[model samples]
Target: MDNPTAGIDRAAPVVARHELTIRAPATAVWGLLTDVPAWPSWQPDIVSARARTPLTPGATFHWRTAALDIASTVYAMEAPRLILWGGPAQGIVAVHQWTLTSSGPAATLVTTEESWDGAPVRADAANIRQALDDSLAQWLGHLKTAAEKPR
Candidate 1:
């Protein structure tokens, strides 16, 4: 498969990557990941989220988080596997990607990667990196909890 974040420089100073294993099927994880409006329920940092149009390539979504409000466009989407989206917010340009792999009949390996650039990100790389790391970790934990619960 093509690299979802191909254009973004991985060596950039303000980049954050996180991965976690979820004991659930990829379909379940993918459903939760793509449901934009439901994000705030599991993602503590997200204040609100609404898709401006259907979630497909070039479609946009507005997201409000504790740090900033961003208008993100879906750059890539591969059902039950990968989704990538990002945009500029508060002087920072960001690209976020989520990849899911089914490890077994009822297990999955989930990874979330994000890259940030622009003036604000470069000005405070350390804090931005830490914040992104923490946020990603929290997101993964929330996903694990949500996915692990019995339906």
Candidate 2:
């Protein structure tokens, strides 16, 4: 399969990827993924998220996290399957992508990958990579917990 991060600079210093199976239908998981405004409620790293326009290609959203405030544009969207978004933040260029697959009637396998490039990232590649790993892991855990909870 072609790498989703292929478009990102191969020289990127920090890259993180994580995946988990969620015991919830893809429809349920997709809803949570696309609802940008509700991110802060479950995503501990996100302080706030707002997207004035629908999450279509070229649409932009503002996100605030403990590390930086970033304005990202949605680059692609494939319904309950995939979404990709990225932009420059705090002097770093980043691209993030999520993929979903229906493992069964009530289970979805989710994967997320991110790449960071720029002088800032290169200056502290090890620490940045570790941080991204931790962040992505936490995000997947939170999503799994939320998705699997009895509703």
Candidate 3:
């Protein structure tokens, strides 16, 4: 859309971004980041997740995070680099994307962005924006923790 996101709604009511540098390679970070079904093990909010083997565009995945059941399609993806996915849930149409870039010999700069629209978001833009920001911030923190841990 208008923002840098791959497939987010161009005119979403709220958009949020959060990023951090992880002390690990992008490949290592990507491996932990993209495996949908394995999310619950590392992501505390992700109660459950399941997706087709080898994520690809148009492949839909179902996941529960923050007690919200979400089914998002793989709108776009690039191996070990970026993924964009989202769909309607609980009266909110949300789009989320993750980007990974190598920052140094063994470091990765991770960026996550998301957009939310629909009646609920439109009605409570400020609160929704903060929620989205907080959610992304938490997700990024988890990713960094998981990715940086010694494996």
Ranking by lDDT: 2, 3, 1
Model 1: runs farther than 4 Å from truth? 1-8
Root mean square deviation (Cα) for candidate 1: 2.6
Pairs that collide in candidate 3 are none
Residue 35 miss distance in model 2 (angstroms): 0.3
Model 1's number of clashes is: 0
User: Per-residue lDDT tens digits of candidate 2, residues 40-151?
Assistant: 8888889999999889988999999866999988888889899888888988888888899999999999999888988898899999999988988999999998888898
Cα-based TM-score, every candidate: 0.92, 0.92, 0.92
Model 3 Cα lDDT, one tens digit per residue, 50-115: 986667888888999877999888887898899888888999988888899999879999999889
Ten contiguous residues with the weakest lDDT in model 2: 1-10
Per-residue lDDT of 1-105 in model 1, one digit per residue for the tens? 134346344866777788999999999999888899999988777899998667998899998987688999888888989888988888888888899999998
Residue 10 CA displacement from its true place in model 1, Å = 0.9
